[model samples]
Target: MAEQQTDFDVLIVGAGLSGIGMAAHLTEKCPGRSYAILERRGNLGGTWDLFRYPGVRSDSDMHTLGFDFEPWRHEKSIADAPAILDYLHRIVADRDIGPNIRFGHKVISADFDMANARWDIVAETEDGERKRLSASWLYLGSGYYDYDEPYDPGFATERFEGQIVHPQFWPEDLDHAGKKVVVIGSGATAVTVVPAMAARAAKVTMLQRTPTWMFARPAKDSIANFLRRMLPEQTAYRITRWKNMKLQSLAFKRARTKPQKMGEALHKRIEKVLGENFDAEAFTPPYDPWDQRLCLVPDNDLFEAINEGRAEIVTARIEAFEKDGVLLSNGRFLPADIIVTATGLKLCVAGKIAVSVDGEPVDFAQRFYYKGCMFSNLPNLAVVFGYLNASWTLRADLNSDYVCRVLNHMARTGADMAVPVLPHGHGLEEDDIFDFSSGYIQRSKHLMPKNATRYPWRLNQEYLVDRKRMASEPITDGILEFSRARQDQGAAPEMAAAE
Candidate 1:
């Protein structure tokens, strides 16, 4: 029998927002490079599909959250999960890229065949049968969500709980109506679940050790809608996207440089709704804004719930869980019929895939990120990581175009491998992947990718700066070492003709 060959020029992992957007980019920017997407799940839309919890929606504005190429024509700037899923489906259908995606193919590992300049991918089908595929480049579109198992804090143990639920594994039939509910954690999940359940529940309480800053934004973008009606589709989208981008950038910088100023403004906004009872010390986070992501309550739903006395906030440490409810460290008890542990997501890097380079196990943390996409010493591989500060798709769009540019540059040079190499004594300070204080990131501890001090190596979370570096920047900066193909036999018969 003839040897099995690598099937595509690029093999994309995970079929979510990132994966779909990547496919669209490759289709438009590098039409000649054939690619295949391997999705472990039987369906598309990663987070929008998996997260079935109540009020699942984007915290960021749709103007920035939506793709650069696609226009978000919806009235609601903050979209629900189903709507987002529908949007993704429409894009896939419109671009005619659905056929290229193979569902139920879970990529477990990738062994780089450097001699032949291809990757031998090991994946298992939905039926648990092992299979292999290969590609010239592997783009990891698998997001950082911990799908297999959510993070259990190991501290909230109780013997006589009615029901303890994690939003990740929310039961469809678990009705919360008329029942007293207690949501644990101070992050976006808790904020969302509280009000959603409050609408039907007897009473809801948000229990947090430390409070997170919450702001209210309009659910619908009236200005964006007006502009869309007045101007062309792309033009309207460009204007709205940039407007949000600049505003977000400015706010983030102000939060960093002037925490007190931002904090005061936040307190004032909430006080206008809650009046005098709103506790500044209780609601105000110890860490500054952008240290942990600020939570957005669209149309002030969370505040409305609080104002209506349907939901209440309790800022205290949990001594432990009791039979009926939770016991506070400061000698207090909160009753609950249902407990929702919206603690946080467990960060997963590179989809937790065991990747090797030329038969050697890749130590990812030791390596620095090359422009937040490619890793140092890693060849022809780009991992899709988004902005820690801004909307994820913003950075994702940049990454997609940059990846195509690198591929095109390689084709022009007749190069098969493009690896990042740092010079000796580059004198770059290594930094953490994110400076956020969320429990998930803190628990991850050193497992995340590193950042260098200097240009090209240090990934900028700023979109304005990225526009110059990721778009107009030259590829041949003496960092990316390019070379010709090692061999020609690995490519599939269909891809054998590609440059």
Candidate 2:
């Protein structure tokens, strides 16, 4: 029942892309600092390890998705789950990060002791054993979506006689070969699952209430492959990463500024592929391009499946799930033996960990985001919520680098606590930083932290501008206040029983 002591200088939550990347940065940039990664799951690789559905792959290219410190040697820029896991494993092994990770340790709550300037952490194992731990600083890389549950569209599954599955929890024993499979939803998951299950399933149908904008591109980056062959591994990786980042930025800008033109171009591309059988209504979304994320169909796999008549798209309202399959509002019934709900993810913030400061609960929605990593008035804490338009790791890499710089700065200045202080009467306009119409984004918009109109206070979407600003901007910009703990709080508490 005694108070737990600080166990590590930094306690990083989650062992996913962001967590591992942050640990790697710590090793390189702030070598003397001691850190530990607490992962709730048994294994690492976060999303890659969690998702077991067929044809699971990255929507973003690997050149940009891979860590900035590590060179991505994989040939396919659009990598599958296994390959991505392998890459992550290699990073852990090479960086000696495996020893620093505590698996099956789920963080339940974290309370920052303002007097001591340290965080008191409570984590529970899978078996429900609670352990106390503490750290000088906390970093949350727990990802954006809920790991325990996927978004439920409130489908009445009891009416269906056949098997039902959600892509988030794909059954290992389930077989689709020769079965009529229908995937519900038009997001990236549905797009990936339809083509993947088409080769085996007798017929794969993608059922959607509304059309989602789609873009087709080759799975392999020809330019990256060529550069890899000609140039050294590291050099090629750097060049390819830079090139892809620029291209991604340009594409997003065009989509935002010229949505009509971009939408038309996407439509034309789909028309060229689908040819005579192209359904304009099914391919064209009511909203503009990048309104929701553009579904990236690598190698035209989704289109190829549709073109081959193996998979089809049904753009209609689901009246109900009948005994055999889904009955549409238009009086059309789609027959299916197996149904996979590729319905989107349920978004979560800070891994749903209960956070507080000096017994006062921290409601992130009321606080403003500081430098897209830290929050206003939160001491010794940083959270990684990556980019929506570009690769998630792009922001992950930047945030990790920025955190490392902050950590090093703190050590140099002998400051025990650092918090972004927003004074009253500060003239700052609130802005909707997410600015996306995606269902998940819209659903969780109220849960997210506030953002200002200017730099350092807002979560900037443009990576190029962020990269320069993060690299060059001074840490002591008066906004982020740094201070030492009071001597009256007593000497540093000794280590408690920590897992």
Candidate 3:
């Protein structure tokens, strides 16, 4: 193999929210440092750019999703996909960050060179050409969603006759109007698809293996709009962001502390709005609220669609797909002209790229998560993963800030590499990280971090705790070690223990 060459101080994969955030932070904090961001798709905005399904909107409030330095000026609190993509584009163009981003480049593998104390990254282009680049630091922000493929059931390809489509890979040419549609799965995507398709399609049926707890909220806030006009953008943004944070935190606390009472109150609210004829069991989730993400239905649109007779909910396991539609395990066959498999996504850690250290592949499955960023044995490589309970950007922002601190610390101390070293006999066990039985999460259990009932590994969704740990706390929490390289040889372990 011929050696291809490129170099950078920092190499970031995926130009989505986290990738862009990482680039912005690095450029601002470490000026004159050569860095590049690689994006697989032709455009940016990872999830927003990929999913083009009808009525696509964020599950979280826009205030929290928006960048801290950049205020989201949308009229709606829960923004549509296009709006979010536009915001990202504006940020990229305004900051002149586009130059640093190399679109249509997909990273295949990354190997850490122990002797040189650098990472060699191999990326393939859309046309099948491959190139290799070296960088001192490598950051993975590829996100969780799989871009090219859908998670269809094994029997789907041969059995289903109707046009089957996944929300993530929705074809632009396929038309859903005037047809009977059946959307599989019960989550944010399924809830969003049913109502939107119902408007144009003859009828839309949402097939769920299990019921999800649905909550109704306005897409736009009158108070937020008022404040935007009355107060400065920064002030309004901060106020709304913090206010939503507090409300969400309070809700989570109430749900956990007084689960029975909170569940009853929520059940009553759903019954009152959905009416006497509504099947309460279909709308109520079996598990406690927040155990899985609470499904947000904008303006009661899904329920309204159901009430209007354009949409219906079927809470049953899909036994298999038939020639015309899906067959339920109970022997009922629902006919559909089109099938939308909103059946969740595949969680790909670090975009499923092979990560190696010193020419040896590192087993992330055996590693413990340090501050949810650094892996136990991986050196000079940090991953940005967000909170499962709060807005993803909240945790990602903290990770970016901390990475900057790490970079500054490295440069100031003349260190070539810094990797988190877990104490001896420390290993994550199964049944501790994710307790959910959801197929997407359960299948990827080995690639994810286990949340112990302790600190760090146990993910605390509270922003205050994350803020104190990432920004205020010392880096030398006894888990990470930094080493410097001399002119004659490679990185030598210098013990300036993190205080």
Q: Against the true structure, whose lDDT is highest?
A: 2
Model 1, total clashes? 0
**How well does candidate 3 score on lDDT at residue 430?**
28
Report the lDDT tens digits of candidate 2 across residue range 1-499. 1123339999999999999999999999989988899999999999999999999999999999999889888889999999999999999999899989988999999999878888999999899999999999999999999999888889988989999999889899999999999999999999999999999999999999899999999999999999999999899999999999999889999998999999889999999999987898998888999988999999999999999999999999999999899999999999999999888999998999999987888888877888899887788999988888999999999988988888889999998988888765567799997888999899889898888898778898889999998899899998888787756445533211111
Residues 59-130 of candidate 3 have per-residue lDDT tens digits of 999898887878889999888999999899988888778888888889999998766778999999999999
Better of 1 and 2 by TM-score: 2
Please report, as a residue range, the 10-residue window in candidate 2 with the lowest summed lDDT.
490-499
Worst 10 residues of 3 by lDDT: 490-499
Query: TM-score, each model?
Result: 0.95, 0.96, 0.93
Ranking by TM-score: 2, 1, 3
Model 1 alpha-carbon drift over 4 Å, by segment: 1-6, 423-426, 487-499
Worst 10 residues of 1 by lDDT: 490-499
lDDT of each: 0.85, 0.90, 0.81
